[model samples]
Target: MSIAQIIGSRHVLAVQNLHASINYYIDQLGFSLVWQIEGWALVQRDSISIMLGECQDDISAHETNNHSYFAYIEVTDIDSLHQEFTHNNVEFVSQLATKDWGQREFAIKTIDGHRIMFGQELLF
Candidate 1:
């Protein structure tokens, strides 16, 4: 029997307001709304998809400290992506920097406080 390979992933996030989070992801982050109904929404950009669920009673991601980090997205053109986010006024947790571990990366915080890191492998 052949083993199946794991495919893609969608990060699920608990947000305080579904509408606002959806707008932020689309307008600021350049994601397109895949679909939305009631308290749930799905947004996508390139190969990344994020599922936003409204949970008013749950703790916000900002309150989770380091646990708030949800995804590390790998991309090819790191510099251009960083510039695009900057122009859109996306709230950044960290600016683009080449790490000693051999990656050029940056992090941003969604309106819901979920953090996502975008990185590209540094070809030394």
Candidate 2:
């Protein structure tokens, strides 16, 4: 009832370059291509899907660099994830660090410069 009360969550990014975006998402981050259309594709990690679509024709409509949004994903092990990222040569914005919020985390920027923060809960 009432629109199913939000079944799941998803994030979408608009890109001028689709192939490169897909490559970075799939080849680097281990996301799988769930679906693709003429100018759009959906990449999934676990049950979460990120929709990457072609940018609109209007240049003004495109989001500017240094002003993009980032995604924060909760992972089980920060050390393991950091190792994988290092092995893959993924450019991490920062090395793993503990936050005041009781999360151990690191940040990375995708090829398109969208940031991703991988975090784990801090143990006592």
Candidate 3:
């Protein structure tokens, strides 16, 4: 079987405020702490992981397009995740909607302005 060639991938993000960024990932975004060094941290949510590193300049998620080149999390249940985030007052770049490409998706911004888009495949 030709499975996904990519076994796993981690996005190393630049974070100006390490602790606060860690807190936002852990507390707000529901990611659990994996481990941390003085200037870096690792957090995970299910199968996905992120590496946050302390930096002088953390770039914005988007430079031109409405959204591009950001982390895309393929989840099992998009509606439930959306509801949970909504209840927690998490900011969203857009509401949950099925795109022409046949995936239901939504996007959110992290404390350091990193954008994460969550999606679920449409069987239909």
Candidate 4:
């Protein structure tokens, strides 16, 4: 694919605590804050950008997640990412392992209970 064929991507997530969520993404995952105001913040790590909005609705994170992942991010080195998050004491839903589809994968629940899976394609 050419550069014009693909654009950037962003994921909007509802977080219960604005400050805490921003801090988690910045400090834990090494994401840099692009901008923040009122109840919204935009953070980025490399080419990926995620928007976190504070939610006041009458719904819990457990209800929001409900056994569903919020997003799937492709990573270059899944093991290094898992190790980095693990070093930060991040809680994981699944330890790193190759899936049945032949991709190395792992899952971690964010502070707001957003489950994000990271994986890399296996050439073999």
Over the full model, what C-alpha lDDT does candidate 4 score relative to the true structure? Answer: 0.88
Candidate 2 error regions (>4 Å): 1-3, 56-66
Task: Return the candidate ranking by TM-score, descending.
Answer: 1, 4, 3, 2
Locate the minimum summed-lDDT window of 10 residues in model 2: 58-67
Error of 4 at 122 (Å): 1.0
Q: Mind giving the per-residue lDDT tens digits that candidate 2 earns over 1-124?
A: 4565777888988777888889888888889999889999999988768999887563421245555545789998789989988888898888999989999999887777777888999877
Q: If both were scored by lDDT, which would come out higher, candidate 1 or candidate 2?
A: 1
**C-alpha positional error of residue 93 in candidate 4 after TM-score superposition, expressed in Å:** 0.4
Candidate 3: lDDT of 37? Answer: 94
Instruction: Report RMSD (Å) for each prediction in the order shown.
Output: 1.0, 2.7, 3.4, 2.9
Question: What lDDT would each prediction earn against the true structure?
Answer: 0.94, 0.82, 0.84, 0.88
Q: Which digits, one per residue and each the tens of the lDDT, describe model 4 over residues 12-105?
A: 8888888999999999988999999999999999988999999967464658655547778998988999999999989899899998898999
Query: On a 0 to 1 TM-score scale, where does candidate 2 land against the true structure?
Result: 0.85
* Candidate 3 local lDDT, residue 34: 97
In candidate 4, which residue ranges exceed 4 Å CA deviation?
Answer: 1-6
lDDT of 1 by residue, 1-124 (tens): 9999989889888999999999999999999999999899999999999999999999999999899998999999999999999999999999999999999999999887889999999889
Question: On a 0 to 100 scale, what is the lDDT of residue 67 in model 3?
Answer: 49
Write one digit per residue (lDDT tens) for candidate 3, span 12-117. 9877788988898888888999999989999998988899889856455444255443688899889999998888778898899999999999998776667789
TM-score list, all predictions: 0.95, 0.85, 0.85, 0.89
